[model samples]
Target chain A: MALWRVPLDAEQIDVTLGIVHIIKERCKGCGYCIEFCPKEVLEFSKEFNQKGYHPPRVKKPDDCVNCHYCEIICPEFAIYSIEAEQEQANP
Target chain B: MTIAQEAIREATSHPLDDLLRTERIPHIWCPGCGIGTAFSSCLIAMKESGIDLEKTVMVSGIGCSGRGAGYVKLDSYHTTHGRAIPFATGMKLANTDLNVVVFSGDGDLFAIGGNHFIHAARRNVDITVVCVNNFNYGMTGGQAAATTPHLAKTTTTPLGNPESPFNLPLLAYAAGASYVARWTTLHARDLTTAIQEALANPGFSFVEVLAPCPINYGRRNKEKPLDTLRLFQDKSIIKNNAHPTELDVDWEKGVVLGTFVNNPRPCSTDMYDKTCRLEEKPEKKTAA
Candidate 1:
């Protein structure tokens, strides 16, 4: 349950730090992750994966507010958010 | 920090991964299909139900949606076409302790499996049936199914379906389902809650999930996946206790969606045990 909610406010408050993990192999090029993204941070890549599906890429990584709608809507489970920080920031 | 960021920062693990058979991923469903959304909602429901995962079993009939059983990391059976209900019934009656769930597509459940459906609901079998209604035979190249709307063009109905379709919710309600509801993939939260309620229910429970079959049903019907979802958003009216008969699905008239019925009744097992007496077996005392 906790994982389901991506906490949009948390991402909005901090603008400098955001990362995303895109497992290109797992992607089926549904474009759902790009289409349903509320933050408009994703776009279909010009390059195709091994499976010939155009996996999504983070076009505006800074604009990502961690809404997780992309993750939720992605049927392939290929794209996900990854929050990163410098050492000694939150550790 | 955002939860996603925090997770990456902390290097924590996800809780839901164990629920899925990751090795079998890159699922066969086409891009923009709604079956994945519906399946994910059902997974959320099962996780939230707090039931014993080990004792739970998933049974699926042959169809694109039937692949749900194979994808879930649980005790599952991918049975022959249109027999998921009977297989699940046998499992439930034999153990009486297992939680059996039947997940399949409209073609498998209502067309080839329609007879089993009525009998199961009539007897009030204790099982949760999730029917993903894509309005056609999605896996087999989108043929007109029992639930396909009139005037829709399918592979088999290229001239447009002259016959009317079955009203799933009305049928289930009339057949004596204890909990019956209809929701689209767009209504994930509501659908999840409805599925949880259905799983908790004691008697025959039915949930009809209206999904988009973009490649087959949509391409021919002149609708994109997102367009179908938007239609659901714009036209869907939530009438929680609406009469089943009045809830016919006609996009022109707006679609009625909600938990149409939620009445608990004694399940078949209870009635059978009460009516028939069984001789008590002696306890084994060998090598004591």
Candidate 2:
């Protein structure tokens, strides 16, 4: 991603990376996380869970900024995100 | 496996698992119902408030939202219908140190329990009341409730609701509540912050949470759950400190959402101790 107006200290800044986690069985497929995620990182999965609902899948995993919007917005508490480790960020 | 897939595989528990009754993995609320969102926000606020969890108690009345008490891992009371406030008031009076929070639905809080709400606020009880207004009695087959919007369709009001809904914030302010606010389930961040403020306020506090009742209220109103959330996102005007009278639940005209009141007053316990306690008089005499 290229910044339209790069800051003087751009090299010093490290954009946080996050990994999305989905608990399939707990999801009721409300689509709240998908609809409200700022990064547009999630999409409905093709496979259904035990309850016969399609849980969300991380489509653009690297795009996530660890906002936790999906976690707070999920009524079912099915999705969350945690910050990526240093090795994972480079890898 | 990709990083996201690896994370999902390694996920053992949610951060909120410690605060919730995890055994009840899936709650009873239906798909697209907003109660769970509001409930989760309340829990998040409780966690963020930095209060002593051991001294806090959650009280709830009978309704769909009333089930909140059962899900929280705390000293919670699932009180009788419309009696959550009174029960909470009793607990507050008995142990002034406890942080009492009443979580109930529009039907439970305003319909049968309406009087209790006003009286508690009027007396300035030191408690936080979270009322989830879904515009109808969702659990009871979507019956018309005290907070149901005017002319809306419900199970009982099939043709259209004839009466107008109560402006909850205005009612709370009028009843002498010290802190009052309104927010929708879609505005989870603001709702959580407002609940935190309500919990910290020294006197009676009331926060009204507007949630979608898709299965019952929406089916008849021609609104899908997503549509209702979109409406909340687009139509809500967040004017902090807006007058209470302007905070009505009108979708077409737009809903006013914010903290309307935050002035502290002497709470009921403090006033009672000041005026009625006999032991305090001896201390005053000795000082003189």
Candidate 3:
């Protein structure tokens, strides 16, 4: 790696995996992901959770990285990272 | 072609059909991986460009997103971790006739390759870039990437991220990208159109597709593919006579998504192309 030699034609990643997960049921419609992700990935949704709180929704799935931070920090363990890609790769 | 028709075209290409790069099949990407979408968009852009496929080359770095060059059958240079841009640049400067495109990731671009991203945008090279922005590093397990959300959990950050993220479009626009547009994979047709426009537009055209990485980073955020798709449909704001602050605008159901930037004063590569003192730069002088 050149340490720093990105070309003009580099792919512009619009969606990516991030570090946080939001528990829809316990989200309380807090715009944390929207306010947090540097890439502007998360957004608030109209749908409410079991507690009648509108949870934060991921607007970009293709960009997520399953960091599991969203689950750990949430007061509620609503958001948790799963090994979706691992299954596809092995199976 | 319309998306439905495009699907037909997609079906026509039998598995392991035409040879462009290497004979790589069933690309080893995750199900619901945005990298696949980014790769497909690149093909759409190249097809729209009408550039000779034999004369075109694709480059990539390391990461789940870096596999583009190998997946699509084309003249691809699967380079090092984050040097895809430089590799593609070398290819272009050496042989301008060859359409050089780089497929990279947020971690590759924003983290390790950040400096390259700025310089390349400033140089205004003649190439079309399609970047997928998923907040974290998807390939090497989940980690806190440059684009990770603040106060979020990551493999590294057990508690939560205490930092902020980058505004990519603003960064690209400020860096002097000749053509810069933003869209999400949810808007597949519009995304294809943006890719087409970026490829056709001369100078450094950057199209950032907000894609989904349902497997790696998404699961951490509790986002399944269907839920993520619905989120895209809800959160996107269509491009029109929208307000500047409209970028920060929120919607009730889905987002108002559409083309944001199309044309602006282009920072021409004509000056550099002429200064290089070479015509069509000749392919691979000595072959690496």
Please name the candidate that would achieve the greatest DockQ relative to the true structure.
2
Question: In model 3, which regions exceed 4 Å deviation?
Answer: A1-91, B1-23, B240-257, B264-269, B273-288
- For model 2, what is the error of residue A85's alpha carbon versus the real structure, in angstroms, after optimal superposition? 2.8
Put down candidate 3 lDDT per residue, B35-99, tens digits, no spaces.
65566556655776677988877788888778777766787777787788777777777676777
lDDT tens per residue, model 2, A1-91: 1222567996898878888878888999988888878778889999998899998888887898887778887888777788878435544
Scored by lDDT, model 1 comes in at 0.83
C-alpha DockQ for predicted model 3: 0.02
Question: Model 2: clashing residue pairs?
Answer: none
lDDT of 2: 0.89
Q: Which model is ahead, 2 or 3, in terms of TM-score? A: 2
Superior candidate under lDDT, 2 versus 3: 2
Off by over 4 Å in 1: A1-21, A59-67, A80-91, B1-15, B278-288
Q: Put the candidates in DockQ order, highest first.
A: 2, 1, 3
lDDT by residue (tens digit), candidate 3, A33-58: 34434344467778876666676666
lDDT of 1 by residue, B1-288 (tens): 356643442222223467888877878999889888888878878999998989898999999999999999999999999999998998888777788999999999998999999889999999999999999999889899998999999999999999899999999999989999999887777898999999999999999999989999999999998888878877899899899997887999999999998999999988977766465633322331
> In model 2, which regions exceed 4 Å deviation?
A1-14, A86-91, B1-10, B278-288
For TM-score, candidate 1 versus 2, the one ahead is: 2
The per-residue C-alpha lDDT of model 1 at residue B201 equals: 97
Cα lDDT tens digits, model 2, B169-252, are 999999999999999998899999999999999999999999999999999999999999989988999999999989888989
